[model samples]
Target: MYNPVRRNRNIGTENQGFGQNNRLQISTPYGTLKSFYERIEKYQKEVRIINDHEFLFIEEETRENCHHTCTFDDLESIIKQIPKEDYGDLKFIILRQPKRKEEILSPV
Candidate 1:
């Protein structure tokens, strides 16, 4: 009987697997934002987030990884996240918006 509404009632009987991990891995990136991990000055990261809602996680390596929104509107803040020391090591993005945009910053 192929019934989509039927729920499986089988319990206790189980097929075994070779390995299992019951703990969450903190190092792994989750949700919509990509994580940037490394050491950073604690309060400096906090100041950046206070100025912009677009700024998400901003913390040091011992505390947590930094996060920023990747959508078009907040992409500038994301670009600013790149550490100046690592500028040569990281690649830059060129978009056609101001990245083509000029001056008009508000909607009236």
Candidate 2:
């Protein structure tokens, strides 16, 4: 499970809104996490810009959270480190909410 408190970092998205702490958590294997990165680094042979600062990446995690509208360039380096294997319990998504682009981009 993704325990930010255990990892000692408030990284990633918050499944809950302000004043709420309903973030979903999942248990991930240490070997899976390590190999995931190893494969990424080896397969990362290209780079593409998403926004001004971010780039595209094959981000994987235990929870299926919202995918940021824009990608960052910095993630390219990080993606390369992941291994090309199933991340066990981790829910892997190449992009964030990939199927909801139109809905996400539409004006309310």
Q: Which candidate's lDDT is highest?
A: 2
Per-residue accuracy of model 1 over 1-108 as CA lDDT, tens digit each: 889778554434463432355543334345535432221234223222322223333323232343332433465455577665544433323221110112243212
Q: Give the candidate number with the greatest TM-score.
A: 2
Candidate lDDT scores, in order, read 0.36, 0.40
Query: Over the stretch 1-108, how does candidate 2's per-residue lDDT look in tens digits?
Result: 686568624346563344466444333466574532233321222335322233334643222554455444545545445553523333333542222333454423
- Per-candidate clashes, comma-separated: 3, 24
- State the weakest 10-residue window (summed lDDT) of model 2: 36-45
lDDT minimum window of 10 residues, candidate 1: 94-103
Instruction: Tell me the lDDT of model 2 at 45.
Output: 28
